[model samples]
Target: MTPFEWILAVCIAIMAATLLSGLVLVLRTSDVLARAVLADLIFYTMICIFLTWTLTNPTSIGYEVALLAAIAGGVLPTLSMARIISRGRR
Candidate 1:
């Protein structure tokens, strides 16, 4: 295998490890806010994984989808949190 492939493999491995650790944190945490933040972390990590895979494969569509997912994933949760917080005050 070439050095570039080896580096890609290492990056994928690190992303997988991060995903697993984030999942564990989400599962073990009891606080709702903490879980929400962890969920956001997981979303970002998945985006990173997707981008990394696309980088290695060099696909235009995959990169576009990853970018869209990253943007939406960040916004939706934040808006939901704001709604929930606002409702609590009413």
Candidate 2:
């Protein structure tokens, strides 16, 4: 395998480990705020996985989806975290 492929594999392995650990944290934690944060981390980790996958298997629409995910992922989760923290207060 090429050096670039080797690097990508290593990155993907790390991301997968992160994804698993984040899931475990979300499951085991009792704090709602920490759960919310972990949820956001998991979301971004999935996005990173998608982005990394595209590196090995290029697709015409992959980048577009990644862009959309990047945008919506940020806004929706931030809003959710704020609302959760405030208990729905303005």
Candidate 3:
């Protein structure tokens, strides 16, 4: 395997571990806000995984999806959190 592949593998491993831990945290947390934040972490981790996978095997379709995910991933979480906080304020 190439050096780049080795590094990518290590990164993917780290991201996977992060996702797992975040999932566990989300499951264990009782607070809605805490869970929402952790869930956002989990979402980003998944996006990282998808981005990493594309590094190894590039495809035009996957590239489009990855870009879309990257953009929507940021907006959705922020909007959702804002909505959640606004509701809580009522």
* Alpha-carbon TM-score of each model against the true structure: 0.79, 0.94, 0.89
Q: Model 1, range 1-90, lDDT digits (tens) per residue?
A: 788878988998998898899899999989877777788888888887877777668885996787689679868988877766576564
Q: Rank the candidates by TM-score, best first.
A: 2, 3, 1
lDDT of 3 by residue, 1-90 (tens): 999999999999999999999999988889998988998888888988888888988878887887798688878888889988787574
Error of 2 at 9 (Å): 0.3
Sorted by lDDT (best first), the order is: 2, 3, 1
**What lDDT is obtained when candidate 1 is compared to the true structure?**
0.81
Model 1 spans > 4 angstroms off: 83-87
- Cα-based lDDT at residue 64, candidate 2: 96
CA RMSD of each candidate after superposition:
2.2, 0.9, 1.6
Worst ten in a row by lDDT for model 1: 81-90
Q: Residue 31 in candidate 2 has what lDDT?
A: 97
Q: Candidate 3, which segments miss by more than 4 Å at Cα?
A: 88-90
Clashing pairs in 1: none
Each model's lDDT: 0.81, 0.93, 0.88
